[model samples]
Structure formats: structure tokens, C-alpha cells
Target: MPKVSVKVKWGKEMYPDVEVNTDDEPVVFKAQIFALTGVQPERQKVVCKGVTLRDDSWANFKLSNNALVLVMGSKEEDVPAAPVEQTRFVEDMNESELATALDLPEGLINLGNTCYMNATVQCLKTVPELKNALLGYDPSSGGGTAGGLTSALSETMRALESGGAGACAAAAARLLNALHAAAPRLAERGAGGQLAQQDASECWTEIVRALRMRLTVAPEPNSKSLIEQYFGGTLDVELVCSEADEPPTRSNETFLQLSCFISQDVKYLQSGLRSKMAEQITKMSETLGRDAVYTKTSKISRLPAYLTVQFVRFYYKEKESINAKILKDVKFPLELDVYELCSPELQERLTPMRNKFKELEDASVEKSLNAKNKSHGDSKKENKKRSIVPYWFENDVGSNNSGYYRLQAVLTHRGRSSSSGHYVAWVARGDAWLRCDDDTVSPVTEEEVLKLSGGGDWHCAYLLLYGPKILEVPEEEEEPMVTDVTEGPAGNPPTALA
Candidate 1:
């Protein structure tokens, strides 16, 4: 039996084409169709060349390359009426089975107004490299490449190593334990029955602090901490004014999280980030001897593999003595290009990788066109591996030379204020989107993730984690150009010896 790549069509729509092995049970093939079509495996009716494929036998159909398939099925099965005799809660269900069946990351239990904490943890957990680093690093050893960490929370972090119920819980628990060590009162709820709310950004900082000190960059023992490896960035900030006599001032600053300030005109996430960098102020400068106009500009000195951008939608309202949220629509792109934010030198350094990325995009388009027209068997074999592994750059410690990033996780908050609002995390795992709202996790779509931008504010994206975009390059080298010995010169071809 041979594996055949087939184009599947349902009704008038064409599903993503798939490659299937004719040797496996048709059920296995059905599952692949399920993932593509949202049609349940049990209910699918796959027809190829006027033959209805059977579950047990795939070989009997004699399927081959470029085969056309018609998959007929429903999105889901009809459920019977619920039994009124008994009521069940989430706790009553089997946790392991529920989580395992859905392949969900473990979720954290919301401790009062700890949704902020939970949201941050869930979002950070989406970084596979960070997770791998956490899984390997020995917290008790008191050894880290990043020198700023304190070993005070060593025993607490080690306790998290024992076991956890789900991925969310494991990540949140470790972070919470570390946070508690930093400030004991943070984990406790005050007299108002509801737990006192803490700033989500503060939670982010402390959690990253613990991780940076505890986690080591294995390759370089004392290079930089894990936090710096993924999130750290340096920016050159310049202050200039309209006055000819006033000299401009410049300084450098480090940042782990970039902020986006929302305003009346702000309708997109990237615009908000730009607004945060440009500061317009009317102030009297003592050195300038009069009121001077000043505007601040900032540009990236270093770009980390993971870029965390926070939307600064909250401001303290004096009337209620509480932090209030801005409900404004800010559309954020799934793929972001930060070329404009980089310094001229860094931008020049990025040109090669940027060109490589453009070449990859061109190649992918050509490949898709080739597959559509050529109908060659080799196209299926060529696509077997999609992920681009062993990706690298020259001097690649903390450089996103391509300046391209794909959104991997989003932390969103709903309601008017930081303390009272609910928080959720939308994480991209493989090609699927999963929304983790405290303990309840459900599969979501890219469209749903997009809708998180804050118009009417169901859930507004508060923070975004963007990971480097890698290109899938062909592993095989191109054949060397054949030397045309017969053509001796450009003007004429030399006569070949008989």
C-alpha cells in the first residue's frame, strides 16, 4: 500500500488538501479529515472515485496520488436531552479525562481577584522554550546565568516540581508560590471577602524576576538570564524640543514589557505602542530659561526572541479612587513587523534575514502554485515536515533579526477596572486557538482571537506575546550548475571533438 496525497472537497467548498497513507485503517484517515473539516470521525462519509471508502479496508479502494475525495458529514453530533434527575458540576467531572481528551493545558483556580495573575501565567506558559528551560533548570541549585534572582523562593519553587493537575495549574502554582515568597500578603484576600487586586503588570514583572534568577541559559553559563533571553530589550530614548537653544538629551533604558497607551484616536494595538513611545509635553525647563516644547522618541537597541506588549488601558480615577479601564477598539495583527521600531544599525543588521523571509514567502507561493498545477507525487512528500527546525542567526543570543513575530498568546481583561475585571488567556497551540478563562478551557478560532480587541469590551487584549516567525526552508541543496565545456566563450560555442 502507498500513501497518496488527495484534494478533499465538501459541497462547493474545498478543504485543506491532505496526504493519507493507504496502509492505515480508514478510521485513521477519517480523523485527519475531522481535524480539517470539523466533521466527527464517526459520522464522516468519504467517497473517492465513485467508491465509498470503508473503515476497515483502505487498500481495496486502490487510491493513488492526486486522488479527489468528497467528505460528507456534520460539524457535530446531536446530543440527547439532558437527564433532569441529577445535576453535575465541573468538579464532579473527571479532570484527567476532560483535560486529556481535549489536550488542554492545565488551568489555574482563580483565587478571588487573582484572574490577573492567572491570565499572566497562562500567557507566559505558551512559550515552549521557557517551559523547556523551567523543566530542566534545578531551582534548588542556586545557579543562574541571570544574576538578579534571589534564592529565598527556592524551596517554594521546588515544591511546585512534585506534581500538578494541569498545565495551567503547574505554571500558575509555581508562579504564585514565587510571588507569595516576594510579598506574603499578595496571596491573601483582605477583609472585604474579595481578594485585593494587584496590578497584572506587577505580577508579570515579579514572575519573570523569579524565573530569570532560577532558570539558567544552559549554553552560556553566565551570559544573561532566561528572562533577558526571551523578553529583555534595550531602547535608546531621545528628548528634543522646538527651541533652537535647547540641547536635546538622550538616554538608554531596559524594558521587559512594552506598553501601548489607549487614547480617543487609538483604534489599533500597533498605533497605541507608537503613541506610548512619542511623548508630547508642555513644560518649563530650568536650564532653557523658558517654557520649552519637548517630545520624546524611543527606538529598539536590542530585540528579544519573545516580545511582550502591554496595552495601557487603565488609569486611576480620582472620583472613585479606583483604576478605570478604557473601552476602545484596537485591532491587533496576528503577525507583526517591528522594523520601524529598530535603530538604524539594528535595522541594517536585519536586512539579510528580512530578505530571507521575503524569499521564503515567494517560494511558498510558488510551491502552492506548483502543487495546484503540477499534480506531482513529490509535492506531498515535500510537505511532510512543516516546522522549520534548527533555525539560527549569526550571533543569535538575543536577536530577532527578521523583525517578524507571530502572536502566540494574548492576555485579555473584561469589565471596567483592573481589580474587579475578569481575565482570560488566548493561546495558540499548533494551528488551534485555546481560550483559557480560569479553569474553563475551550477551543477557539483565529477570528475569535481577533475579536478580543476592545470595542464594547467583552474581553480586550491587555498584553500580547509575540514569538519569532521562522521560515521553513528546503533541507536539500540545489544541484550544482553543470559546466558547459562545449561553450568556450560567450560569443560562440567551441566545436565538440567526435
Candidate 2:
């Protein structure tokens, strides 16, 4: 089939010279009509000679050159409730229109070598709790770097939310100023007197610290600050002196992030994390009365709703006077189960939720198989929406119920070192992912994202943000709806189908 030029008629207006390709899906034809009428494909209803057009096929209708077709739908803004039926890119729709139609978040513009800051900002915006805390932040709460950063960040987030398809350099510039003023190292210039590119993980740490100072709203009554509540965790530490005949010393420490030291043996993220958890160090031993070798062991006693993991890929090269990166291929999982990383008591506490997750997975497999068997032909399987429950603990609002998490964002660095590299943020958006390379935001596949696991000069994952995995309550024990009744006419309403 060949391309045919047709004129489309919408309510009172007519769009002529619209090109439609007969060989492609009918949705493609709708896209052509969308280009002319500003109506999204999902909301569009195409009719020709009283026969309706379906998205899957166009076999019933014969489209010819100069043929008149009827299209009906409101503009994208008018139908805000309509779901996105397809992925539309810059080639299909302009940036402004794409943002408006898909409700995609705006991108941040780079100010000189500020991609690091931009990437961090974009990744942090994925956290709803943090954004809400920032929205309620008061600059008068404190004075100095923390206050300035809080104020700047609050405004930047607001602008990013509402300023669609617009430049975000001004907000980013204020943030850069606040950060540079707080951390002098970030303000250092290159040999050419140009602003130096900084590390995204460092930027992330400083911003988290600043927000922790100003956004003091606790997740629960009489708790720590919002940042700590959502991002902080506790580690149970034990030190056994090698030369002393005494019991091991025990203590607890709070941390904002976990570091994964990447060595030659570190082939996966979990392995690196486990190696860091226990190590041999030389420290002052009170029992031995001297500096002695001791075995230091650490286990997580508390897991926050949001977890930050940094790959220790950079090492200081004294001769080169630069931090060189290691290009090792370390695989990471999209869904992570950190049960092995928790303390014994913490692991026991996390068991119930972990069991529930296992049940859900089993049931999901069964349901999928049943659906596949019931289908008459080789029809594609329908992607069923999983039942979602709160990721946080029921008793603790900002703590994880299970030692499981789903990767939400990844900050990758390209080039030899963090100081002279490009930084980009890859954030999960529903089932899709978006790559924010400074000002340019584009859709990327999960495979593309996973390829950032190093092994080459390509972009490698430097920092990862994992949010607690959404628990799916089993159908047998699903919470009863408000309409559920103990005694219904239809024998208890057939167990109130979930």
C-alpha cells in the first residue's frame, strides 16, 4: 500500500493535505490527524462512510487520495483525564506539546558545568515525600547555607513543576551558588578558568544535608527530620579485638547512604555491599591497651523508605592529582532483596512482608498462565496492573516494611573521572524510563538503562536511589471495600471479588 493524502474534518474546521500511510497501524493514521487537529490519538474517533476506524486494523475502509475523513475529539488540554495511549516523541510532537499531552515532567537546563547538580535535582524530584517537605519548608527556620539552599530548592522544584518546556537555568544557578558557597571544593575552577564539573553523588549528599537542616518535619510525631526519616538508616556495629581476650564492643550509627567498594572481586552490587559490611581495620583497642587489628562488622538494623547506594568506583591518584574511575561491569537488580544485609532481629521482623511478596509472585505466575491458556489464539498477554500497598511500615511511617526495594533512579557518569565527565539522571516513570541529560529529556528503555553497568567508556552508574518495593496484598486477604457487607443477598457477595 502507498501513502494517501486525505482531508480531515473536525467539528467546524477542516484540515486538508493530511498524509496517511496505509501500511502502518491505524493509530499512525490517528497520529497524522492528531498533528492537524491537536487531538490525542486515544481521544480521537475516526469515521469514514459511517464505518468507525479501529486502532489495530484498517482493513474495512479504503483510504484514497483527496478522500474526506471525519475526526472527533477535544484538544489534549480539554481531555485531561484521558490516559496516554502511546509513546509520543519529539519527532511526533514538539517538546511543549509533548509535555502537555503526556504530563511529562520538565527538564532542567545546564548552567556551564552544572550537569551534576541538574541530574541530582531531577533524581530527587522523584521522591514525593521530599518534594512535599520542600514545599512546606520555611526559610526562617534557620540561617546560613542550609536556609539559602532550602529556599532555593523549594522555588526550583515549584518552577520545575509548573514551568513546562521552559528553561530552568535560573533556579539551577541559585542552587549552584548555594552549594558552592557551602562546599568550597565544588567552586574550584579548571586550568582554563572554567567552572569545573563536580560529582553528582557529592552534590546529592550536600543537598540531602541541607534539606535535612531546613525541612525538619518528621514523618511521624516526635521523630527525626523528614530527610532522616525517609532516607536515613541505622547500622549495628561490632568490633572484636584481635589481641585482646574480651567481649566485642557494640554500637549503633546512623547513615544517610551506603557505600559499595568496587574491587576486582566485586562482580555484582550485592557482593560489594557485603564486602563493605564486614572488614578488618586497625584501631585503638581498650582491652589490649594499644592499636590492634580488629574485625569490624556492621549490619543494618533499620531500613528507610528511600535508600541511596553509591558505587566507590573512583580512587585518588596521587601522581595524576585526580580521582580515577574503575570500569568494572557490576550487575545490579531492578528488584533488590536486602534480607541478607540486615541484622538477625531486623531480618526476623522483615520475614512476614517477605513471605507476602513471595506469595504474590507465585499467584501472579498462576494468573498469567491461566490467562494464556484461556486465550483462543496467539494474542498478546494483557499487562495487568499489580495491586499496590504502601511501601512504608505500618507502625513507622518512614521505614521500610520489608528489606526489599525497587530501583527508582540512577545517576551515571561518562568520561574518565567524575570531575571531568558528563552526568545524567535516569528516573523511572511508571513502566517507562526517562533519561535527563541536562536540558534534553528523552525516553529510554530498561535495557538501555541496565547497560550503564560499566565495562567501558560509556555512562556508568555512580549512584542509585532505591525506594521500598510496593507490597501486593494477596487476593484472599485483600482489605474489604466500604461496600462489603457481612450478609449480602448473593451469598456474601461471592467473597467481594478483588
Query: Which numbered prediction scores highest in lDDT against the true structure?
Result: 2
lDDT of 1 by residue, 104-187 (tens): 655555534667876776687676556545544544564332211333223222323353433233334344444665756565
What TM-score, over all chains together, does every model reach? 0.68, 0.72
Give the Cα lDDT of each candidate: 0.67, 0.76
- Model 2, 137-242: lDDT tens digits are 6656555887787777887888787754332444565566678777878877777545688888888988888877666543333445777778999999998887
Candidate 1, residue 51: Cα displacement in angstroms equals 72
Q: Which stretches in model 1 have alpha-carbon errors above 4 Å?
A: 1-101, 142-177, 184-188, 218-222, 282-286, 289-291, 375-381, 384-392, 477-498
Off by over 4 Å in 2: 1-103, 139-142, 165-167, 218-223, 372-387, 474-476, 479-498
Question: Could you say which candidate leads in TM-score?
Answer: 2
Score candidate 1 by TM-score against the native.
0.68
